[model samples]
Target chain A: MEIVRPTLLLDKETCLRNIARMAEKAKAKNLDFCPHFKTHQSAIIGEWFREFGISAITVSSVQMAQYFARNGWTDITIALPVNILEIDQINQLASGINLNLLVENKESLVFLDKFIKFQAGIYIEIDTGYNRTGVAAHKTNLVDGLLEIVKNNKLLDFKGFLSHTGHTYQASSRHDIFNHHFDALLKMRSLKNRYKKDWPNLKLSLGDTPSASICDNFDGIDELRPGNFIFYDLMQYKLGTCKFEDIALRLVCPVIARHASRNEVIIYGGAIHTSKDSIINIDGKELYGQVIINQNGQKILLDERNYLHKLSQEHGIIKVTYKDFNSFKVGDLVEIVPVHSCLTANLMGSYLTSDGEYIPTIRQA
Target chain B: MEIVRPTLLLDKETCLRNIARMAEKAKAKNLDFCPHFKTHQSAIIGEWFREFGISAITVSSVQMAQYFARNGWTDITIALPVNILEIDQINQLASGINLNLLVENKESLVFLDKFIKFQAGIYIEIDTGYNRTGVAAHKTNLVDGLLEIVKNNKLLDFKGFLSHTGHTYQASSRHDIFNHHFDALLKMRSLKNRYKKDWPNLKLSLGDTPSASICDNFDGIDELRPGNFIFYDLMQYKLGTCKFEDIALRLVCPVIARHASRNEVIIYGGAIHTSKDSIINIDGKELYGQVIINQNGQKILLDERNYLHKLSQEHGIIKVTYKDFNSFKVGDLVEIVPVHSCLTANLMGSYLTSDGEYIPTIRQA
Candidate 1:
């Protein structure tokens, strides 16, 4: 609470605005807004979504689903392809709540069919350009195989096709994001058209912050589950998805040392606090994070040259410009805009709200 | 204990051997072995060093110092530049134990001189080429000013010059590592020679796993404080510091999906478990970790092409060769040799020993 070490400061106002904007976008499009809880991972923040008429939630793992289910969230979906090894825990969660699981292959479906004792919704994970996971959208045969097993099991309920357009994160421009999202939409729509006769009530779910924030075409998307929008970071800003002011988190670290000869400032934050997530700057060097000096009630964002350059276990070296080197001193509290807020939030395990209240996340809970 | 999720498996026999080897190296050279505990921030692992006559320990932060001190480690050195903001905790630790803090500038010494209530040893951090922190070794005037403040304070005991040649991690070859270590040695020795007359007993401390593992030069060095040698990783292997067998830790993750079209295997282990630390492989691609499949009572290290290629929040995409693709199946547990063990260990918070014992790290403790 005293801010002696590197602490993540969460601006409650910015986060509430982010949540409201995303919820409004989903409402206008008539889409079920099942925002992913993987970013914030806090039950308190999840409770804030209830005021916007949001009930359903999405998580990346079964452990997260159980955590939210215990907190009174009934409708939950585990977004990752189901790890069959965790079927026991999945079965336990399904027995209590309306749980949905993602399956990309028949192996996981067969395992679920044989082991699950309670009713669980199954969403076929379709790969639409994002080759991270999921079945290829064109591969209807694999989809038919997975559905056949689900149809035979009375405890399994067929939901719909789910896809994560993660490749939008690599978009070089707004045009690139639009093009990738359109291509993915076509692929997902083709599958929906082919299976509409058998599954008339099926839903299509798509997620990823880039396309969800920038692209306006949610032609066939039934639900939106963009997680990082809750705390848009430098990566989202670089991808043209969010503005700098939308970033709701900043790592507050104390400047421990200042080296004028080399024009560097050392801070207590490092790779352990902010994971080694970086972006290539204009100078073709790895920029870990942007620095901001809040002095005299004014927040001054340092120039491009004064960024977090190197990180060790507990030491972050910021390459300060000659013009800004004298502005820092020992024990000065500096703020670093993290490149990826999700990883930083995961590492810090908890957050200090703008009003100084402690918000405990899943890691602590 | 069931290990259904991504769990770090520690081979205790390998860790014990690593501890003995580094302790023997320090003994053979008559150097005081104060091994760095930042790599394995475990009180259980700290107890392992006691069997090898390692009484003094080195840590990276005041919190780690307190954690070890609570675990009965009397003598400890926080190897990072002193964060004057934590003067209260520093004073508390110094009052109870033999604590030493690293200082690079005069401001922190002045802070310590004014507020420290108990005797605390001081190490003047000298920059020998690692431009991350510390004063330049040749800057005698800066060193004089820092010592002047320490000499005037009765509670501060001047230990000596300490150098962390961390630049050796970027060495092109073992010869380059030797050159960097030798250059750092000359600079530290120069400072010691100039100050030996004023302070009769000043010990030169040096650390860095690359130099401690490969370079056979310990002339004029009194203490060795390398940490990562306790659990050698893929980065150390690439640096020619240790063999694959010496890597004691592995993230054992369950295989969730296998895509034959992309020749990729998606595992439950990901950036959250492995910490996105990578090295460029021979094919000019990022290699996150090496894949090792332990099936049918045999461990097989896949080829370079089958390395863990991509990482998401909770998913790892391992690009497998055609020959190695068929060997994997859904629900099979595979091991990933992490890129940087320290970050991985810190992220995991706990470890599962090969003998099925649970070991809690500092983050857990």
Candidate 2:
């Protein structure tokens, strides 16, 4: 692709390999591999997973479900807690497909039952340790109360228990990820064992890229919904979840100016292009992103010694040793591995594929 | 406006007041009031500045300059350095109107001279202390070389020196902001003074919200281009650049779930909507944003004691005291004073005015 201001470059080969790896893992475990489409957010990219016979998918919002549903995704689970205000959208999205909504309380279930005209699958979101959302797994009374309301409503189908181990992103080591994944699996299994007698076909779901990529003990988890594996970022790399070769996306920005005195090269990418998500550096500064040099269309990740250290609104300052900094002049294309790929992809609404094809994502208003 | 998800709400009254305030400041200082339109990247919001008798404006990208130019803006200076890859678009933009391009190196100037067809004004960007981009103010030989080349070129219109003191954002006290502003003013003045004998009507420009809002000295700075004053956010509020009442934009999001045990409320807004820019709270945790209850159509800023404490990809956890938490019910709208308004505005891409009108921003594939 031509080097412009800032282009999000996607390597289709790497993305396909990533998709295949996760799909094969789920198949090996005899689990439902419902990859979360929120990471790629592209119907074209989603089709790459269809080659693996994956039909059901997971999204974070109702609008996303509608987007993918219109694009021929028949079954979509909105993994976020139900926003009662979006009942109209939820009903509209559920009108033609098997739409799933997560609920932790009876208020949302009652609101869905009263407003939604079409059949909507409901899942009681269990807090398996993330603590960001979802009901505590030990809160059996609350879970039963929500389940009771969901069961009483003819329009609502009680799907199962769903939980997301998001805290794995903060894990310091692979052991931490496995421990979090283990605890989540134990709580979800215990909850499923308690309620399986009442509802025979309820499915247990766990989704998170870090745990899903490293852990193999998926014995009872019915469905797996790991996104980000398709385009693992620096955060995943730091968490020891994915290797650098599996990263499918890189932000190609133009070198605007060079500060040879400071050994810094500034680019046209910043917090807007790569959202202010960052990991702590060894020097205690926020590592906005890392610099990579592309040779013959292959991205070569640089050493951690040189990285995009500081960012303003529309400017990124990369601190490099003179040898690394001397390799580029102004107006040359500089590739950066964003701190978080999902946010970077979101900021860049479209992508230029490796074959020089521009593909629009599902972020347009 | 009905906010089913995270909605960017714009208050026209306060925004106009802010525009008037900065314009009046520039008028009082005998400086050109060329405000930066990068913060509120909306043509409708741009029209608000026209009411203050402002014509020439500054944008951060060529796409944004083209956007405003297509909507009848005649003069726009792209504050970013010229990217050689966008030479075609720059030529197209420069053909119809008086376009300004920033250049700091000889390579970009040579490319523009060879490729650009229309006359484009050039400003040599000087670095005061930000170290993000631009040539150092002390590099007189480099500046003189660039001037010699520009003088030899017919298509390049040489404007004066321009520098932005971005370090003002990191200032601990008002005294630090004053000192940073003072240093930038001195460096830019010395550069302009060195070249003023050659070019009689050279214009010196400086832009940044924190320093511009606090500093009264504009001895040699000929133009002011402050942007964030239009929608001052938590960062500016913390830096004493703007009052909370002057903050015109707020992200109105729905409360999807409430965790009473943790005294936390989960909102549908996340890093995708807020951009993950944060500040430190009193208790030493990162505060992504502060919660403000919308009293009728007006936003009332709450105490900093209760704020958004944690964030995930699609969820924001607001740590609230029970009293503040109980005031908000699930599905109730909560306005967030984001840590940085510029990034938040870019993410939302549109706004719902307080007068109940929807305004679409200039962001599309």
TM-score of chain B of 2: 0.97
- B194-223 in candidate 1: lDDT tens per residue? 999999899999999999998888988999
Candidate 1 lDDT, A278-322, residue by residue in tens: 999878999989999977889999888999989988999999889
For every prediction, compared with the true complex, DockQ reads 0.86, 0.77
Cα lDDT tens digits, model 2, A1-365, are 56688899999999999989999999899899988988878888888888999999999988888889989999999999999998888888888899999998767777787888999898899998888888899999998888878778899999999999988998999999999999999999998899999999999999999999999998789999999999999999999999988888889999888888888888898888886788998778889888887666775677877899888878888888887877768887888988899889998888899999888888752
Candidate 2 docks with a DockQ of 0.77
CAPRI quality level assigned to candidate 2 from its DockQ score: medium
lDDT of 2 by residue, B298-327 (tens): 756677778988877678888888777776
Report how far off residue A217 is in candidate 2 (Å). Answer: 0.8
Q: What is the lDDT for A227 in model 1?
A: 98
